[model samples]
Target: MIQMAKQYGRQSPTTPFLMVRCSAPATWCFFSGTNNYVWESFNNPTDTILPTQVMGLGGMLFSRLTQNNYSRGRFELHFSNEDVKLYLVSRPDDHYYRFEMFNATNASESASYQLVFNESAYINIVKRNGETVPLPLISWRQSTFAPNSNNYYRATLDFDGVFRQYAYPRMRSLIDGDDQSWSVVRYLPDNICNAFPDQYGGSGACGFNSYCRAKGGTPSCECPPGYTLMDPNNKFGGCKLEFPQGCGVLDDELKDPMESYDLANISGLNWPYGNYEVL
Candidate 1:
């Protein structure tokens, strides 16, 4: 694909964009800029997709380790195939969300389904019988920044394992000198914490000993009192106890672990699972 894109770029250096379609299994189709600005594959998705991209029956989206690392993370988004539904799975193979929980799945006996974000950014799961249904909790709010921004919409399976949609304005091509400007319209998963249900054992919701919250329309993680970051570099790695698990000696016991520890009660904080024990 890169070679083809490069050849096309050399032939039409001034062209704004080129859409390439192929029959190979590795890539179905892609859009490449005449220059070097845009390169998006509708099939080779890592963790993101633009509106109108079709996630085929066997297609998958794998999250990244960190924001910077592109290697496969512990989370994945794929068609369940079992019930023709879309599911997001994390490490330990726990299912977090059924991304496509449409009523159509249960109504049809189709063995497979296709997922796609319409040009207007509406998520739909298409059954083999040609029935289309909208994903649950979809956002219908119109985009104020780019009223007709269907041409530039994005949906990503975020590092936090939340699937979200975003809109971008149609702006002038970097080299084409054509006028085109657009911005984000609307996104999904109204509440970040809501995406992480408590039924999945909280294995992929967030790091252990950490709290998950939504701030500025995004998921944020933080450690509570009496604990510090386990890996200061990776917040998702979880937190470590500031105090030792048990005193090893009389001298260790003499030094009060609770001297610096203060009880903290956080209200409205969301956990991947319930804090109360089943007992």
Candidate 2:
């Protein structure tokens, strides 16, 4: 399509802004810019990918700093190779997501494929010869309205490193003007706490000294008793010691070590990268 766009006359700058604003730009079959399609939004995607767009090999999606902050976040999904691995940049050496896209022994399946998500709420593997394999999603929400005409779909790599699919209805002229809302249709790694294993190079789901608890598919970071978060604004930010320890404080330990020290005995907590045998 890049080669074909070269043969067409040059397009005005406004033409791109208008076409890209369309609900389904793919259905319009309009190439954004005539400049060899170089300066196109599709070529440079932010966090969300619209329907009918394919995330080809080597493509990557970086999340926002926070849901409210649009700057680049610590989490990223780099489709670096065919296996389709996604690593949490907080721990670059470790990856949190993976899936094999091809079958080495299955001769019937095509090797060249594209990951496509359309009006449907799930992403699928489309082969060059029209063969397809539907990826497993937790659940397909029964559409409350006509999806193809009334709604638009998007898949986003969220701030906290969870991939979610959303549906937005065209509520330009709604009976209830306040009904404009984006509904979450699907999300990957349903259990956010389990995304990062117990044995870790970095903090598991939350930062060091912070407990990661899953509340309705979202990871909630909390400080255990006797400790406080480093930053109240940042929940995932590591926790800190409330006071100085080891007998070097104003409230010096006059008694013996055993008598002065009392263990917090917090349950369900583990050392992030501690070396300990299960035996």
Candidate 3:
């Protein structure tokens, strides 16, 4: 709701127009003029989940984590509603990354990949056991941003998740290929900051803080191993634990309050007799 870009900067232009407005109702948005990224997901929108996206829903439905400002938090992930199977949650705690979704009508021939939007966006999409494999069709070009001029672009995914992409130039700038110079063929995957960090760690295996986005690509983080950081502002809370344990309470003769103990003959215990008789 607020997508504007009409020659606002000027870059090739001859065909590029994108404009969208939403009010929220199972919100879902995705726009990528090939490198200008935008992916918004609020509620529901089956099929078309990008950005290190993972989907496997047959029944059980429970994937929590809403209150960063969305409201609250604590649902984590529950499945068992009937038990279907949909994993792909990795972070400092909740870990998962199982996949299953590549049926294709009945299964004869149908696999696809190549999901790159802009700024080096990424999401190669590759499945093996479950099938689905054959992705490579993202390629685009035509934005020297100056020549014949006639370009307009848009990509949005904002309900709070934040995802954007924009471009403009509808009445100025044109040089090569003329006709108002503005060409964008299709060869995406190089923009989203230079996507590659396990493709945002969707299934690439969460590492830093956890983030894998698609509108193009470029979103990385991962930190879990004894924790560190204190607070860069709050990356989930910046992690903590680095080794600090001591709540006290342990002195009953070294505290052993056993409930049961009997390991055979014990007399100053020094057991481990195998071959030794040198007296």
| Best candidate (score: TM-score) | 2
Model 3 residue runs over 4 Å out of place are 1-19, 22-62, 66-84, 88-108, 111-249, 259-279
> On a 0 to 100 scale, what is the lDDT of residue 76 in model 3?
25
Cα error of candidate 1 at position 133, Å: 1.6
lDDT per residue for candidate 1 within 228-277, as digits (tens), equals 98877777767879876655345545656566346688998654435575
Residues 81-166, candidate 2, lDDT per residue (tens digit)? 34555566767767777766665345334335667765554577677677776655433223232345677788888887777777
Instruction: Identify the runs in model 1 with alpha carbons over 4 angstroms from their true place.
Output: 1-40, 82-94, 99-112, 137-151, 172-184, 248-261, 270-279
Q: For each predicted model, how many residue pairs clash, with residues at least 3 apart or on different chains? A: 7, 0, 43
Ordering by TM-score: 2, 1, 3
Of models 1 and 2, which has the larger TM-score?
Answer: 2
Off by over 4 Å in 2: 1-38, 103-111, 138-149, 172-178, 247-255, 258-261, 265-279
Q: What shift in Å separates residue 23 of candidate 1 from its native position after superposition?
A: 10
- If scored against the real structure, what TM-score would every candidate get? 0.65, 0.71, 0.20
Choose 1 or 2, whichever is better by lDDT.
2
Q: Local distance difference test, per candidate?
A: 0.60, 0.64, 0.32
Q: After superposition, how far is residue 276 of candidate 1 from its true place, in Å?
A: 7.1
